[model samples]
Target: MKKNIVVTGGTGRFGNHLKSISTKHKLFFPTKNQFNILNFNSMLKYFNKTKPDIVIHLAGFSRPMELHEKDINKSINLNIIGTANVTMACSQKNIKLIYFSTNYVYPGINGNYNEDDPLKPFNNYAWSKLGGECSVKLYKNSLILRVCMTEKPFIHKKAFANVKTSFMYHDEVAKILFKLLNKQGIINIGGKAQYIYNFAKKENKKVKKIYQNKNMKIKVPFDSTINIKKLQKIVKVKF
Candidate 1:
């Protein structure tokens, strides 16, 4: 059956791709100006007006991992507190909340982390995302996607040969998103596990291969690939 849905943070990379898709359900992509997540009343006002049955919370601070380290307050306010406000609004309106999290929430080493696996965020960025997860987990009608997705065309000119990941494109994940709208609790959403160099090489042969070094400022995860068995079973599509 068709349902009314609202997507927050429609301006983001994934959210932009999501707007291009055609689905049976009606979707509303409200800009932050229209539905500011930090303002709980704004979310409630939008929900009350639209009467949506589902709210995809995609508004959060991300990108430039350095920002999280430098501006911890903004990270906490946007990703953590903003998400909590969204959850509260969703709960009051009885809307199914689908949150966008990250695969970085899992311990980097020892890949194949599942939904039930123990979490240990790699950096301050991941920690902020996990903080949002905590609030969404409280709501009974919520689905958390610990997604491993990135911009298409392989943004980086260099790929980490030593680091492994399950990086899928934003559009790829958007294609399968509608199928999992009604799912509750958390789901590990990603692609097949592969070395970063291997994944990027397929798209750009000129991409340079680099290994994680101790001198590097950023904390590189040796392996942060997530298991997508549950997602495959539901979508009936092999990754």
Candidate 2:
């Protein structure tokens, strides 16, 4: 059956990929003006207008990890508070909420982390995402996706040799999203566990190799690979 779906960050990287492939569902990718996640009134108004059965909450601050540290207020408002507002609005209307979280929520020391693993965010960015997860978890009708995805064309010139992760391209993830919508609770989404360099080389053979350094300015996870057995059972797609 077809249902109305509202994607909050519909104009973002992953959201754009979803729009390109979405043909079966009635999806509404409203801008911040149309559906401001930070404002409960705005969210309620939009939800009332659209009467969506599902709302994919993707509006949040991400990238340039340093920004989270530099401007904690922005991170708190957008990633934390904004998510809370969305969750509250969804709960009020009894709408299924799909939240996009990060694999960084797990302690990066161990690889193959599962959905049930205890969370310990490595950085400020991860912490903010976890904050979002807290609200969504309180809402019964919600799905939290601890995803490790990146854009296609592998923009990075030098990939980490020592670090391991399960990074899937946005376009690849977009294909399997519909199967995941009906799922509740947390689900780890990404590709097979492998060295970051190995994954990058598959897409860009010319990509150089680099190693994670302790002295590095940014916090790099040595092993943030996530186990996706649960996701595999549902979608039957090789990550």
Candidate 3:
């Protein structure tokens, strides 16, 4: 059956990819004005009108990592309060909520974190997403995806040599997402564990590798790769 699906953040990098991959489902990609997630009343009205069976929540504070650190209020409002409003509306309407979280939520020191690992955010951005997870956990019909996805073909000319992460491209993650739409609860979505340079080299052999020193000022995780055995068992994919 082609169930109705609403994808928030339709214009975002990942959300846009979901639109292309979710052609089999009855998809509605609404702009913020059409369904302002920040406004509880607006969210309620939209849910009542659309009456979708599933809501893919990709809308949240991302990019310019500095934003989360500088404007803590906005990060809390968008990721936490916004998520609470959406989950509340979905619960009332009996709609399934699929949240897009980050792998940074896990303490980066531990390389392979499972679904049961305690959350220790590496930065304010991760903390905000974890805040959203808190609200979704309150709703029984919610699925939280702790994703470590990135752009394909090494979007950048230079890659970090020392940073290790489970980086899958936006398109690759999009396909897996469609396959696991029906499943619920927490799922860590990503690719194999490897250094940033090695992961990028797969797509672009010519990609330059620049090593980041331990004393570097950048506040990034050392090794935040997740254990994807459960994801593989469920989705039956090698990703």
What is the C-alpha lDDT profile of model 3 across 80-128, one tens digit per residue? 9999989998999999999999999999986899999988999999999
Which pairs clash (backbone N, Cα, C closer than 3 Å) in model 1? none
Candidate 1 accuracy as TM-score: 0.97
Q: What is the lDDT of residue 97 in candidate 1?
A: 95
Backbone clash tally (model 3): 0
Poorest stretch of ten by lDDT in candidate 1 = 212-221
Of the two candidates 2 and 3, the one with more favorable lDDT, higher being better, is 2
lDDT per model vs. reference? 0.91, 0.92, 0.88
The C-alpha local distance difference test score for the whole of candidate 3 amounts to: 0.88
TM-score of each: 0.97, 0.97, 0.96
Per-residue lDDT over 100-158 for candidate 1, one digit per residue giving the tens place of the 0 to 100 score: 99999999889999999999999999999999999999998999999998787999999
By TM-score, how accurate is candidate 3? Answer: 0.96
Error of 3 at 134 (Å): 0.2
lDDT of 2 by residue, 25-105 (tens): 899999989898877898999999999999998898998998998999999999999999999999999999999999999
Error of 1 at 75 (Å): 0.9
Point out where model 3 deviates above 4 Å. Answer: none
How far residue 100's Cα lies from its native spot in candidate 1, in Å, is: 0.5
